[model samples]
Target: MKTVQVNIVTPDGPVYEADVEMVSVRAESGELGILAGHVPMVAPLKIGAVRLKHSGSTELVAVSGGFVEVRPEKVTILAQAAETSAKVDVDRAKSAKQRAEEHLNHPNESDVRRAELALKRALNRLNVAGK
Candidate 1:
């Protein structure tokens, strides 16, 4: 089976770099899967979990928002913030989710967008961490 080199990067540092049998992520339009020999393209990614399959194991990573560049032999993810399942703090994420929920419930347009983004990020982390 052929594989593609996948590198996930964030402002902090590189999250993961490995050869993956397959990669799936949520694009702005919809979910997309990348495989080796895929045509080159770039797409904006949404806040969600990125699934990476290699060998017989699958890994999930949470991305706040970013872009994915796919080439024939490689896939690169540039995320605003990214965290692996092990790196996610469930308690912290839960707290953030609660705060965002509270803020979103209020009728304030200025903070609503930020709160919504926070909620999405927290939920994405929780989902990826299997919490």
Candidate 2:
């Protein structure tokens, strides 16, 4: 089986690095699937789950927002924030989602846009965590 190197980097550190059979992510335009020998490209990522497939195993990572750069043999993700499924705190995400939702529902236009973004990020994390 063919594999490509995938690295996911965050501000804190490198969150994930592996040689995987395939990677799928939600780009700003639409869904993207990358495999070995894919043409070089770049895309803006959205707040959603990143799916990696390798050797009969599948891993899920939640990304708040990011950019993906794909080379012939490598796929690099520079994310604002990312968390693996195991590392995601479901309870915390739930609480955050509730808080953001409340903020969005209120008439505080000053922070409403920020709150909407927070809600999306929280929901993305929860979805990736299987909550």
Candidate 3:
């Protein structure tokens, strides 16, 4: 089976670096999949989960937002922030989700959009964490 070198990085540092058989990411256009020998292209990422499949395992990472660059034998993801399931704090995510939901329900004129984004981020983390 063919594999591709996939690297996921953020401003602080590299997050995930691995050779995988396939990767699926949330792009602006929607969910997209890439495999070894994929056409070279760059796509803006959305706030969601990045799923990668290797020899016999699958890993998930929650990303705030960023861009992905795909090449014939390599793929790179530059994200604003990222969190792996093992590193996520379920309680914190749940709290954030609750706060965001409350804020959204109250409909604060100034913080509504922020709250919505926060909710999305919280949900993304929870989803990756499987909680």
Q: After superposition, how far is residue 9 of candidate 3 from its true place, in Å?
A: 0.8
RMSD of each: 0.8, 0.8, 0.9
Candidate 3 residue lDDT tens string, 73-94: 9999999989999989999999
TM-score of 1: 0.97
Instruction: Kindly list the per-residue Cα lDDT of model 1 for residues 1-131, writing each as its tens digit.
Output: 89999999998899999999999999999999999999999999999999999989999999988999999999999999999999999999999999999998884889999999999999999999999
Pairs with steric clashes in candidate 3: none
Model 3: CA > 4 A from native: none
Ranking by lDDT: 1, 3, 2
Candidate 1: RMSD to truth: 0.8
lDDT of 2 by residue, 1-131 (tens): 89999999999999999999999999999999999999999999999999999989899999988899999899999999999999999999999999998998784978998998999999999988888
Regions more than 4 Å wrong, model 2: none
Clashes of each: 0, 0, 0
Q: Of models 1 and 3, which has the larger lDDT?
A: 1
